[model samples]
Target: MADIGGVNSFRSFARSWRRAASFAEVIPRRPSFVLAPEGEAVDDSSDWDMDDGRSHIDGSSEHSTAHSRQHLLRGPSLQSQGSEAIAAEFSDGASDALLGGSPSTRSSIFDVPPHLAAADVIGSHSIRYGTINSVRYRSRPSVNHDSPWGVHDEQIDPEAAAMTFGEDNPILVKEVKQGDKVVLTVEGQSTLPQSVFNSINAIIGVGLLSLPLAFKMSGWIIGLFILTLTAAVTAHTGKLLGKCMDYDPSIVTYSDLAYVAFGTRARIIVSALFTLELIAACVALVILFSDSLSSLLAGFATATSWKCICAALVLVLNMIPLRWLSYTSILGIFSTFCIVCIVIIDGLVKKDAPGSLWEPARTHLFPSNWMSVPLAYGLMASPWGAHSIFPSIYRDMRHPHKWERAVNTTFSFSYALDTCLAVVGVLMFGDGIKDAITSNILRMSDYPESLTVVMCIFITIIPLTKIPLNARPLITTADVVCGVHREHAHGADAAAQPSALVHGVRALIRVVVVLVLLGISILFPAFDSVCAFLGAALITLISIILPISFYLKLYHKEITTRERVLSWFLLVIFSILGLVGTIWTFLPKQLVAA
Candidate 1:
């Protein structure tokens, strides 16, 4: 036999074993190279076929020199050294070919950096880090640039290429943008019915009180046309505003929509408008409160004292947490019902009572001239000033996609009732109607003082209730712009509770906001003056321009030519209305009267 136990035979076996071990390849624990699964074999067929498809390769490698032939044959055995002594099986001539890389990769093996070469080991079962042909890998044939035709080649992110998606997964993919996948979770989202009613209440606010005056300023023929037209147009605007939110689900306020449509300048302009509107609204509220309570008390309290009392009441009322406001909105429904009853009843009473308390009935079919058209046009736009909060209502619905239904329902009810009130009040009282239909009732009434006080209280409460609803959006938009809102948003990963300091700071901000508004109310107590300023500027922007611009920018291609023409027409018309109203705002009270 072959010298079974002799020292010389033993020494020869040892030499051959050491030679195999010297070139044995294995996976090494390195940071850059991902590890293959334990005990999994390297895929030999999928990787470098001595034909890794990069650079020049002629199929005539079959007729290549002995050196190339040796390389092609030895590459597999050298690469297949997963857990076995594979390199040993490769011949010494083949070993030289294998170590020298491929005809396509390079002729030299020393191309591996000195630092990398120093770290390289074989037979340790450590993963090899090198390129063969065009393929590069860590542990196994995780990447395969090799092609059956020896044609195309591409590199993958190594971490990506290393993923073995497993037998269950046929491919791998990743997101292009991460935040696009994040979902929004608005707290206190209303059920469909509640949301609809909340929208109704929001849409049918103090603006309805002015429509009869609009009917007087514009002719009844023009007034009715403009009134219905404004409703239809603004409702469409509300729809456009809602659709813009689809561009980004993260939008939570009206100003945010502005931010997305334009940029920082637009955002700041919108924020400034909202802030301005809120301050004006609070001023209106103070004026309303003082007027209502003074009307209630008659000789008992001064207007200034009534304003102070109303301010105190407002401060207390606003302190009620937002969570409770949803329930308070039901109170708004009652307020609407009572005000409607009061209007109808007071009209009946005025018709029956002595005409001495009312104005001499001289109703104008058209304006004495055209200066009044600005106020009339502005009045039509003003009723739908609820556009700012429309998105908030839509967002807080359970099925937000059906928001248009809620909007339509709101406008339908508000319009029907407002039209009734405007036509009836103007016709019954004639030119006797005050800017507020209720003012007619207050003036013409020979009613019980108890009824007058009750009417005053209801009038006061209606405007008072509106302040917080308006202020919330302003506060929310401020938070968003200032970067406090994102932190405040209660994400799934958010902290369980805010720190006490955070709560205190938030409370302080709310106080500061309310105090600033209170100061504005005190300084500019002329409610009509404030209304004219905002009606000209802020209301026109929210009700007309912003919505028109958003729809045109986002979906101009989708809109029909006719629709686009009509939209542009309205945009131009409203732009002019906004300008005229702005000029009208600066006119003397005498000029407005003219």
Candidate 2:
């Protein structure tokens, strides 16, 4: 009831404890330790405060006590008492007790027992044990900044904190003792289903549109095998990222884990890959929008006008803050579902209209060379694809360990739909499937007006849905590189917000990135090569290489010989896939075909 558990309240309680002790020497608080229940000690961190990143207990207790009055009982030498209890109340429950209703509330300062200063916290780095009336506490930080992967104490449940220590009953809410470890199981932010949906939204991207092309190029048997295999490997890599996160619970990004495993260089490489992929995605999205729109309204607007319109749309979309854009992922689910419907419709239309879709193009079961394999890989992987967002999605999930399920679920659902579309397109139109299956629908179908409208919706909404989701990674990368953390601003702590200048710079960066991508998209209106290149190069690198690197590097002892050999084999194989695929994609069509 006294708000004694708060950081400020703890300071006041400590000050009052010193004052009540009639101490002549005032010790200024300077990062004192919190006394463990059975003599173990732990450092007091800033996690005590809900929003602020500042620690509550600062300055020496001696200095704080010098200015205080002693609230002491004249009767007993409490040193004679064998056992003492220190009630550590929770901030969540303390207000009710402090409101003067709970029988357990200390009515007077003297209600606190003697030997309240039992802790060894009189000096630097030593915790002072205390027999307090009632003090509140919060969970500690998940990991240390320097040794992020080290075994550290994690915050336990408030209910669990109520249990007493052994041999001596003291401390109401349980605090972490030396060597005590707990996995943080934070909940109530997002539901499991929403997390699954989010994972799906993140993993499913523009790649789905071109899956049929992958099947067309790689042969239906090989293409289907590669797609399924890619999904399994992608899911495996996603789980690897999850395992990396387990080393440090505070790690919220892939780069953070990279820093943990390989230090600064790895982090920078991950960041660079992340930024480039997002930028590439931005360029692809712009080109996709312009190309699709230009195709739809061929006579209505010029190609330049379509490019301008697409650019303007992206500019407007990026204006929305990164957090609010999550709904777009949900919208992406709808768009993806619509595209699936369109794929099925395209197959059905083929039965009635035969060659009514548009001018026919030849279908091929194989590209002229094995190098063309990267084309399919690029279509599916797209320069590493959405694995970058896996950590963010996992961090939001209710059960962190269940991330594997989410990953597998996302891959399964997305691949099933994609496979259906891909197979349908490849079967109906054979190798005539365009880079985007939607193109097949447009150029190869002679459906009714209703079908056209549905097809248009599929085309328009799918890209629009993809825009914000794809741009999210780029916006986030910019925010990080630009030296600002606006996400903290929206939280309970205002001080965590960056300055106006930083926000301005972030906005400027976002603007320049969009403009550059627009220019690039306009310059190279056909983005198929860019997509293929990114998929062949970075997708192979990220999806195959990086995960293997992390696992083989970080978990050498945990993994076995067979696992190691397989990992190395994959590394060599995918590295070849990436290199050959990239070179194959950039070659002239005649050379590539021959």
Candidate 3:
């Protein structure tokens, strides 16, 4: 009876120990070990959980039990099979903690191994053990083992750990890096806007306005040319718009569009043509101002001195910031006001000058009427020179569908303005409107000098405002050409910088081109002849030929039915009208004088 009781007691203790160790292994607090009593050698039996209902020993013999009891008197060593099992349990607990599980409950009975728990395991000494309880006991290192007592190692809470390691690891970092690179590239570059393109178009418009005035052609013939010019320009612009849309729309600029259409050689040709046109226009403006001043101040000042002063004044005005205003604004405010004044003066004059308003009608059958044809032709051609504006306007429009509306509005408004001016000028000047009506408006005896002065000022402002617009295409062409060289010699970043070097080079090119143009103007001061030649050559080339050529080049194979019909019409009309105008303008006086 005594022996059986002792066995049952030992079995109960072992069962309790196994249960505690198993729980500790899973929960994972710290490293654990088993110890024997004071002086006995270590037993060889492996420590394990058993499933028997009764806690009494079943596998071991009586001799083995005695040996295990005797071994309990000595301190534990890991060499024993039972000690290995205990070490494994503790190791399991430590691994669980590292993998983010809670500390094991069994760790409360035997503290974790010091070596395993130390923060700097790579450099720290291994843990040692000392017994306390009669059963065997070990002290646990405090949870704050890495720091001083009462000083906690800041635990990474579940929420923060999950956010940092789980959520934002690779995905967020990649996204942030990409965003940063894009912003840096965009910030480093400068882009030109649609407004700049619109100004270029307005400059072209000024040049075209003089076309009809210079080509002694019929209104119907001029109208045909205008229609052909419009169709060609529209087709060309549509093709460019298509190209721009093909790439990323953001990458397309006016300069890029021009380069895409005409290539590098075309840029040079266009630049030269633009320079010549501007200089001729400027000279015409200067002469018109000089002549007006000579006539207005004839009694008070010498014609030569007045002309010099007026020329100097115009030069000074051209140099000022007023040159930067939009062409539409300048014309709308000054030119429109002048036209209104001319109409008012003409209306008032008709009351007293009785038959003068009909004078133009009488001369309609005369040879002088042929002069009006050229003048009207030049005037009509002016509005058609608005090709460069297409890119600007196209970009501004919200959608391609809006293009027709915007273009039609602009053209219709321009045509109305031109037609009204022509009719009013012919009626007001009668036989005397030989020169530009604005110029001869002051000479009309029935009109007040104040009105004429206003008219002169208004007309003067139109040409003055156009200087910057005229200079832009040349500047842009030079910029693109030089920019290419700079990009190759330096890097893209260096070339992109709008520094003193870029501005200086651009300015130098402008000065050189303008000087060459000024030389041409001096050699050919006849406004009528310059306007005629320019109208016949550049206006036809830009408005008629270039558009057709570009459209065919860009979309010949893909043209729709409407586009095909329009293209054919443009080709035929432009060829016929351009050829006739060229031939007529070049004919000798003896051939047509009869």
Candidate 4:
């Protein structure tokens, strides 16, 4: 009987595997544009690498060409040759590509016919069409000073370079035709190590500070389970995003991916969500900066006063361009590491049992109140909520195939760091843990004063630096909306600098934005609450639901039953969790008592 059961189980597994294999075999890569005859002009920039961000077009095709080469798209191009076959690749047959295999196998870049270069391209701001064998490409610009986005285009063997010209690959942003000779820009890519470093940087942030409290709110055991579960699920969704990008290497940003999945409506919704998230994040930073500083200087001033002062300081500093502070951005990761070390060291040195630092407390395996578990869900989700930019990191990678490994490494490191903090906090404070573990550490009866000062400095200064980083994109978006910035144009003035009026308006807008952030922070001063709400709402949708939905939507027919089932299950679970947590956050305490 045992042998028969074993055989039956094996058969079931084999059948399921076959079903998956069949589905994989049936999916088709998104259709690419058919190659037009040489000299036949086509306007297809809208079909590829389209972004909402204003294109920075310099009249010099050389600069644009250099930029395009740094961002080479790796995927199979459309091999069909005909004028009638060109259509938007957004259709079902064109978008349903199965994902697997290395970059070399999963993609084959066919040479684009020489004449296709006459049309406007989509890969970079400006692309000069170059013929394969006779192509004259330039080396990438200086890495240290020119490429702020960290682009590097190294020279490859000419024979190997010829394979990157399929119609579906290497988009030309602005076609600069100079005497028939195609000027192809072959760009270099970010290596596996660089990609891993970037992914780690994105994943680790202020959110880790809240994990200790998350464990306190949910049962420590439940929190541990939830942390592990959230990491795995979020990483899976990140991979889904990578798969979506795989279908069309042109998908550069989260909003771009949305546009691919459900058209204009999806793009608008995702873009709006991203904008709101940025504003909310700035508000949170304001509160965090003020909160940390006020804790240290309790008798100095009112909380509202502290917030305004900080906002003013940050606004003044942010008026300087992002490039000025680009180097300081890396300090964010170091600050987080330092905070974690302080928490661990303090947790070890302090011999106090649960509740000694505050009110009576006790360590528990389960939460006393299950109602708070959803909030914990949001809190735990925060640390793994960097999915908004995962697509960007994936696109920048030299070996796009190693994206899964990068995601795994990032999550593993984050999980280990979060777990260490949560365990120490739980063992020491239990339910009494503050929203920020650092806050709880500061209250310890015998805590080191020097360490408390250092923790406070990290909390305050780091947010100050981040506020501008978060606000810069929003400011640029505002500039476009207000016409302070212009679209792509021709002539010597195409790359002309913004006028004085434009500069004045930009500075005014930045001030208004900072003031608005200050107002919101003053109104909602709870750091944990802000973090939880953002995590529950925006982060949940961005990091969890949307990626899965987009992937399933794009590859609906091609995906296996198991894949579909698992995806839907995760979708339902997280949707409910986010919704419940968001609603609970605003519910009246009186209603809860009833």
Clash number by candidate, in order: 10, 34, 29, 11
* Root-mean-square deviation of every model: 24.7, 17.4, 33.4, 14.9
lDDT against true structure, model 2: 0.52
Report the error of model 1 at residue 153, Å.
Answer: 38
Each prediction's Cα lDDT score? 0.53, 0.52, 0.39, 0.60
Best by TM-score: 4
Better of 2 and 3 by TM-score: 2
| Model 3 worst lDDT window (10 residues) | 168-177
Q: Comparing candidate 1 with candidate 2, which one achieves the higher TM-score?
A: 2
Could you give me the TM-score of model 1 versus the true structure?
Answer: 0.61
Off by over 4 Å in 4: 1-188, 354-361, 486-491, 494-497, 589-594
Clashing pairs in 1: 24-122, 24-123, 26-125, 26-126, 26-127, 27-125, 27-126, 27-127, 28-126, 28-127
Residue 128 CA displacement from its true place in model 1, Å: 46
lDDT by residue (tens digit), candidate 2, 256-304: 4454455445655775676667666667766666666666666888766
Q: lDDT of model 2 at residue 578?
A: 78
TM-score (all chains, Cα) for each model = 0.61, 0.65, 0.53, 0.70
